[model samples]
Target: MRSLGVAVAYPDPGVADELVHAVEAEADLYLALDPARAAVVLAGEEALSTLGEHPADAAVVGVAADRDAIAVVARAALRCGAHEIVLWPQDRAMLRSIVRDAATRARIGAGRAEGRIVAVAGARGGVGTTTVAAMLARAVAESVVVDLDPVGAGLSGFLSDGAEPTLAAVVAAVDDLDPAALSAAMAGHAAGRAICAEPREAAPTKQQAARMLALLRATVPVAVIDAGRAADDAAMAAISLADQTICVCTPDVASIRGARALIAAAGRGFPVVLNRSARMRLSAKDVARVVGAPPVAVIPDDPAIRRAGEAGRLPSRGAARRAIERLAGLILAEASDGS
Candidate 1:
């Protein structure tokens, strides 16, 4: 496993026990305010300026003098990307909740940046992980690509050929694969770009999956696996191998609750993309409250995407396309910054 890339800055050791716990054994924190460093821990509004010094992925906590000042601190903390802001008046219970939320967002943003492996799974069914995955697959796939879902799921039909070449072929060629070779095996997009979306009820084994993913990454700047409904060990392994995972959910209570676990299961990092959101059922704020972190991006309920799938056509260059393209840019930018 890669090191948990984290950076934390706390000037005072007032809460030494909690400080140690915040770092966690597996994570490598960039503690900015330690005595060893010439760091002076700033408080409240001043801390926002310090954000540029910290890695974009690091979770920051702004310690204030008291609870009453927390709201003021939190506003600045949000601007600084300081995930959480805390006050001495508060106890661990409330503080921990706030801190955890910020830390999780920090982790998620960082994870997705480096071609993060993500599994877009629906809570139960009909939650649209497939469609979300298919659109996202096109969004991230640049050079080399891998679509884990099988043909006939619109990914194959609309984005690429259903029967020509698939991720299955890439898996078969794993032993001798390189970036160029893997790129060759994927299905091509509108601009002659390639993708690997082979549907198999039994996905590749974990080790096999990892090796293939590693190889695919070597050739393609991005590799997207459409996990489909098969959220098995192999699929989980694929998701784990990813630098970040994107859990797709709807606004319904069931989808929200399921998305919560899916995001959590992806570990401390990985963004949650709310798909087909319904304001009547639940708002983005409601989803955020459930998931604890604001969704990296919220996609509205658009039937055109489904219609495009049924017609075996890529989503038109309309509202959905504009949103998706922008979403793609955000995802790619995040990838470049290692967020």
Candidate 2:
């Protein structure tokens, strides 16, 4: 593990020294005199106001002396943009854990500027969200497809030819989530691809879901996640952490209505992809108007898709593949623009 650069600020030198002694093995301790250079800022309740005054880019962790004082300090810390608040002595382990996470985030964030995460979620079941996600993963170099759909066919089965450890093992090691751990958990597939999807038995917790995405993003250039129908906590976590969330829907009234509701609930700027079926009557324009955002990409009904699925092969070339590639380009463009 890389050493975390932590800035310690407290009213008493003895306390700061004690903190340094405790974390010195894991972190590179620094005085909070120059907060701008620090990855994480640790401040006593009294010194919390100083953090606000400086307004550094580092994540702030406020320390309170005891449980009784923590509530007041926590509110103040939050108001001052503190990432977390810790009760000193009582919550030492928790404090260290938070600080370590903050430091890891800071380190990974600085290393990569284009490791974008694109999550695909279905407005309703059977909307081809997993297909789109797998296609997008194929379009991107050094990409991984993470399946958060507990009930759906695993991405490994749909996309990969080889088998290895699944996401079940990864979630089991959530506390040690990193590039190496994720790589070990990932299953090898054809065409130089990797995927992290396991059986439903090893579903991750909400925090684990978020951590999985964060750590995966640190290693790969693009992470294409099939978030399924958002019926579970892990799916919800994937949606929340995604850089770009693509809601896939058919052009039917029910699908459009569900997509619209999902888009509204997902907040502004999340794009929708219209997957046209053979029995579709509603136009792309109608779908867009209902969803409140112009369609980013459209996939028309293609028998090639069905044929490929039946043959247990991904669509290599066809209208469907072309459409998915176009959608991938649009997602890449958006990621570039945001970066």
Candidate 3:
């Protein structure tokens, strides 16, 4: 483990001394003379204005005098991008934990090659975006899925054991998000790992969404994000960050119309996947004509897929699995070429 540099700034002389002492007590922490170069910054209310000068990834702590002062500085600290607020002398242990976690993330991200990001979004609700994203991730080696849907069946419910420290906890601590924090939030899946969304929880801000994706890029070889219908900031952020965006829709008229609208709204045409294409009058060419892009993959409706998903796994041998495997190969090839 690498020692992290910490810079402290407090208006009160006594509080400043205590903070310095606390930093010195930690073997993995050291005082830095410059705030811009430090890995962690301890800033008082008066010092909040200078936070903008520090690195964007730097862990910022707002020092509060007591419980009363916390309320006064909490909103301001949040606006100034402080990761957490700690009371002097009382929350020393919490401060140590925050700094150490930041250090660990910094060490892990250092010199790591950023991974390929793929976003799968539905033309409308119930178009199988989560299924496609999860299956594609499963087909690829060393991949992880992220659920950015704000109001849908959670990805973990079907793929994972519904573990704690979910996306709700991650967005709550977005500013302090690190590789370790993200790893803790993930639920292990047979396909890979997943950060499941909490449908009832508030959506992450654009900055929070971007930060999460950036951390994922640093932590894994491939990240597949289920953007649902791209109705929220997190979904939009994933689409924007992805190396490839796959727009999934069925062969029905409503689904094709929705895909057209979504593509128009995005101002760019994404590769289309005609999912559940069966017994419909519209063909792949018809969808291609309407969406302005040829269908990249057409997955047939398979009952086995639904059964396997309900059972918390993907179909082992079926046409659905074969189609998903082909899509995964295309994504991997694109990622390799881009790399």
Candidate 4:
């Protein structure tokens, strides 16, 4: 684990050294004059008055030798963003535990700074956008599939069936979502995790959708969003927030034209995935020229895919499965490289 930048604000210099040494290996513990940059800040009761104001997000700890003094100092520290209060000497073990936990979380958060939110949008219906998104999600270690298509319900059945909390419930409380709440809301599948959106039901605003995606990426390795055929504000918000936007399309005339228009609307440099290219009207290169975007992946048509869907199973082996796995690898590799 990487070390965390911890700041100790104590009146007595000797006591500060003791606190710092307790968790030195886990954190680059020091007495910080600037509390803004520290991941965890230990504020003694007497020193609490010195920290006028600091970042609300930083984990602040109140330290005091006297039990009565800890309560008094904690109340003051709370106004300055103290999340934990501990009595010194008596609570040294607990204090070290808290600091170590905070340091571990800080390291995790820093690592998650590279998390990617990829949006898979279809030019028109039946282009296998949801399938591509789900497959790519399954490739990643920790991934969440957000089904923004209210009508398709493809994602709802893509994963393992369960009566988990729906996306609607999560959107209702978008302003107050925690890690536990989000994990509970998402339905588990053998392939990966999914949060199915309600049909024809509008709950999350565009801003809320952005926040939800951001939170998901913060918690998970990747967030694969199936933005369906809907071009609503919420869907647009998802595309806007995505680290990469992939437009899925077949090589047919209508699919090509629709894909071109969707890519143009989405903005320049957005990649396209030529899916179901068995009886194609044009090649991947031609499709790219027409769409004005390069083809990031090409998934061949396969009857086994349909059979797997009917059997409630993902394609275990075949050209389509292999292609999807390759596409998933490409997407994840690109994300890793960029990060």
What is candidate 1's lDDT per residue for 45-140, written digit by digit as tens? 555666675555555667675667677777777676565566654544464445434444444445422334445555556776666665665666
As for lDDT, the candidate ahead, 1 or 3, is 3
Task: Name the candidate that leads on lDDT.
Answer: 3
Candidate 2: stretches off by over 4 Å: 1-106, 109-114, 190-192, 277-280
Candidate lDDT (C-alpha), each: 0.58, 0.73, 0.81, 0.74
TM-score of each: 0.59, 0.66, 0.67, 0.80
Q: Which structure is stronger by TM-score: 1 or 2?
A: 2
Error of model 1, residue 183, in angstroms: 1.8
Better of 1 and 3 by TM-score: 3
Clashing pairs in 2: none
Residue 285's C-alpha lDDT in candidate 3?
Answer: 91
- In candidate 1, position 254 carries an lDDT of 86
Model 3, position 296: C-alpha lDDT score: 96
Tell me the alpha-carbon RMSD of every candidate. 18.4, 9.2, 8.0, 4.4
Error of 3 at 171 (Å): 1.1
Q: Residue 174: error of model 1 in Å?
A: 1.0
Residue 316 displacement (Å), model 4:
2.0
| lDDT winner between candidates 2 and 4 | 4
What is candidate 3's lDDT per residue for 1-339, written digit by digit as tens?
357799998898998998999899888889998988898888888788777788777777888887888877787787886767788778877777876554445433453335778999999999998888888988988788888886884586654565542788787786776666677777787567887876666778888888788787756778998899999877888888787899999988899989998888887878899998887468899998898878999999999888987787778888988999999998888877874
Instruction: Please write out the lDDT profile of model 2 over residues 235-273, one tens digit for every residue.
Output: 878888788898999878888888888767666558888
- Clashes in each model (backbone N, CA, C under 3 Å)? 20, 0, 0, 1
